[model samples]
Target: MLTDTRNSRYAKLCGTGGKDVRWTNGFWRDAVASCAKSMVPQLEHMFEAKEISHVVENFRICAGEAEGDFDGTFFGDGDFYKWMESELYSAVLLKDPERFQRLRAYISLIGKAQQPDGYLSTKQIIAAMHGESARNKDINEFEVYNMGHLFTSACLYKRMTGEDSFLDIARKAAGYLANLYDQAEKTGNVQTAVCPSHYMGLIELYRTTGDESYLELAEKSIRLRDSVVDGMDDNQDRIPLKEHKKIIGHAVRATYLYAGVADLYAEKGDPDYLRVLHDVWHNMVSTKMYITGGIGALYNGTSPYGNFFKDQKIHQAFGYEYQLPNVTAYNETCASIGLVMWAYRMFLVEPRAEYMDILERAMLNTNLAAVSLDGKRYFYENMLRRAKKLEYELIWPLTRSEYILSYCCPPNLARVIMESAEYAYAVSEDSVYTGMYGENQAHFHLANGADFVMTQTTDYPYDGNIRLQISDIKKDGPVTLMLRIPGWAERAEVTCHGRTETYGKESAGSYLPVALSSLEDAEIVLSIPMKTRNTIANPMVEEDTAQIAIERGPLVFCMEQPDVETESLDQIWLDPSAEYQLRFEQIDGRRIGVLETTAFQRKIWNGNPETDPEGASNLYRTLPKAEFEPVDARMVPYFAWDNRGVGEMRIWMPYRTR
Candidate 1:
């Protein structure tokens, strides 16, 4: 019982707890541990004020502990569940007894709060107690949404600790959901607009228990989305799942629904699902996706042609084909995390290197950037550019505060970062593939059922050099090791047992396959040249046309106000022909590379013509021959922006292409 990557048809890789593979030393291992150590303790304080109180207070409502109103938001219950899941993931690796005790306490309270018939949603239960009309009929209340998180969290907990205390509560709750939705599916009366996210959880329940009814419930939940309601545009269930050629609607909901579709396709191998999955994925990456691997282009912008709701605007949906925005871009952190989830599932089904590329892009940039360096504060909306205004911040500026009203992104980030080791490596029948690079120890079996242990040493995503050593071999036959060739690498080379090989046309954005008959004295050195290069957006994207962004290896770089003259990010333009020097610097506890470039700033001024006629005449006159001044410009990783008290930051800078 281990939490590993499982498609409906295949298991790609076991997680860190599995006997097959373990992480020894790496940037990811340190990141996972550091984030957990900093975050898990603070969560009790963070949630007690809101999320944890909701669950505890709701339990007391039934038990008559005190006369009180229902506490917290409707989705608050899921936040607590996510926090527990993150703690359990960290505890299993660290074997922390104190954390395990805390988990047991939470489970005990949750178990006590459950109704005898297996219903466990705190808000719905309270609504019933208060004699509210149609307590369970309103799907908009997120009844199943909270249940979904509960089911998945319990499944992972059982896998990590072999503990069934919480699993018992989860199973009972899952049974209730199956019965209710199964009946709803039969009558064609289900609510599709409320959200179809519960499909993923039902699949998890089926996977954990091998229950056919649970799988059937998930299938019905997905298929029933074709019954469109009036205001479900945000849910993306407007079209039948099989006919979705392009991704649309709420970005988080869109990716979560697709992840469930991928799960179903893995199990049922439905051609319709597979076709739509590929179609939507291609549509996103080719057009809708930002260069930082972020999705969802617009927030509450109205085009006067956008269809419905009181807001009269499409909220957080992918707008026109190439209408990506910068300052007002609403790349929610949960949406970015959902993209990674969907991509990982696709990778397991098809085993494509391109999927891993997108996964890496999301994990290294927008996803990691959601949390501050101290792991204490969080960002709900990630903006590509932060603009300054004298009265107030133009756009919602990034903050290092721990709490937000819609506190969904922080816990999700914590869990993903803690469990990142599981996404690093994958083992197939006759091959082992490196999904993401980091220094770590991995163990896997060959085609002959013999165990092998390997150690990877590197400072990855910072430097491209990696060394892999086969430390022990139980038995060896024919084996192939696949190394991923990142899309940004100009060149890649591998030296295996003193024989060197260079990358060619066939290797770019693909895997490099190396074959060996035995593992004795096996040491492979892989070096991918990392250099600072300018990035250009699609010419169709009006916001970024003719502007350039910098990227080094897998990291996207931005010009922050602290690193440049104040309010000069927009003034400076980079000379693409000029060479930039890389300098190592310490940011917080991490060592990051900074790029120094010689850039030029053209001076310009415009005044209110009505107020000063002389100023208006001067503006029409020649402006000192439009002199351009040389300025010193520096860039840090885009993820590192907003750490210096944040006045302004821009990723897309004006550039001199010639």
Candidate 2:
């Protein structure tokens, strides 16, 4: 999101900076508050706690400040960079001077670790110290991904703190890349991109510094992919990206690829890039994406297409379309974060409601679910469903872990969570766009040199009512404010300047452009009905054939074992007509909306026919008609699950009608 394209010809909207928006109350405010209090400090401890993560120690050893071997994952350097970036946001949000100073110190240490040539990968640096060969020049060992994080974080550091030390390291690193890629081309060392975060990084470098060479280098990097002699879908290199029709490969790599491409489209407006993005984005949303806006369906599987003889196995990848299996799903948290990034960029380039909807869905659900409510534990893979017993051991823990050996997700989610306020509002030459609804205040400085400050109050997603007050107009005339009418909301109404207009389903998924004039005591308001809706999946999705997923506004609701009366979930039926009681509950000391309703648990006949004279032990029986016994059922937001304790959890369930 720090990839600035506000003035680009193709970018329809520009982001609001820290001075422009602030989350004061409601769900997002609570999430950010939790991140500052629990998530960041805890992560700082864990990263410094060498037993859990040697991320800091690796840097220290590389810089000759400490003595040790490289002791963490190949990508831990990038993970640490992301954490540092998250702290920058936290420091600003809290206005804590000590926090800001700590971040400045960390960045200075990072500067010390950077090599003279601007090359800074801890794994490669530490390996070189022991006379080991540098690993595959940024492709195989993910040096490029680390560089990508470093560049963006450096750019953020420059923006937030006005520091040049980190930025200087990033610039040198960029210079190093420029030389390396040229050398790679001469030596044929460029194979293909793996975890291609560098693409976004290079373009952001161009945006921040206004340098032409970095932008050209980014284009060259994408071009290099077309000439790779041997490629595989495991890294989305099976074919040229422009020719890849469906998104199938490592989820993080694939989404990161698209996100970088989206950033490219925003700057250069390439038709091929836009086409490829649309194709991949459509395929992902309609077929591969989860109901909770999660991506990546397989824990481990081979890419279904390409030269079968040549393509390697795909790990943590998107499986065949509609091959959505709940219990065994592998929706990596970082992949969804990439989705949010890509969707935001796409909306900036094309400005569609669907894109923002996807962005909002992923951010609210899977991104929030990746970390626990307390923000201490984390999930490497976000499985849609969990069971009490299974034939196979969980690929990861059922509940979040305090420390994952592959610790990319926790910090990746952290930075995104800390900066989520940037995603809430956008601006153009004459109008301000409200992208996501939350309780916040906005100071809009339009490209046309007009300025206005707007304040909004809402209990959105829980309740649809929103009120806005505008003040301190600087322009001579009225400016348009484009309010997003989410694709999900129907039967909504808006009131502006004492004129009210109502809309139906036809108006869903489009922006309502409202022109505002200076007023003394007028308020703009919207009331969207946030009824608990029963969401049914397509019949092609076998796991959710007859089941329904519950949603209200933007929140997806799920049932955990502790919230239900029944011991087993196999026979539970949630009646669609059952009136849901909207109740407020304290979760992790935060008041969140919860739904309580009546559900039925089908009786299981487990008795042997001859021995017990009831039914076969198969837990099946033939009756005149299937009947279910009433059971107490309660549902909480999907993001809040697993926090109560690990047990059977479900998003989709059997359905019945009154």
Using TM-score as the measure, which candidate wins? Answer: 2
Estimate, for each residue in 1-658, the C-alpha lDDT of model 2 and write its tens digit.
4657776777888788865688889989999999988999999998898888888888888888999888878888888889988898999888899998887778778888888888889999998999988856556687888998888888888877776888888889999889978987887766765778888888888888888898888888887887676677887876887997899989999888888888777878889888898888889999999989999889888888866676478888788889999999899999999898888888888777888889999998999989888889999999889986776787688888888878999999999989988888877778778888899988877777777678889987688898988778665336777778887887789998778999999988988887866534547898888888899998899999989999988999999887876656766899988889889998877787889999988765332235634443336765534568888889999999887776889999989876
Candidate that scores best on lDDT: 2
Which residue segments of model 2 deviate by more than 4 Å?
A: 135-138, 519-522, 606-626
Show the colliding residue pairs in model 2.
none
lDDT of residue 444 for candidate 2: 76
Q: Which stretches of candidate 1 lie over 4 Å from their true place?
A: 1-7, 10-26, 50-56, 59-67, 193-195, 301-313, 390-397, 446-448, 605-625
Clashing pairs counted in every model? 0, 0
- Give the TM-score of each candidate: 0.92, 0.96
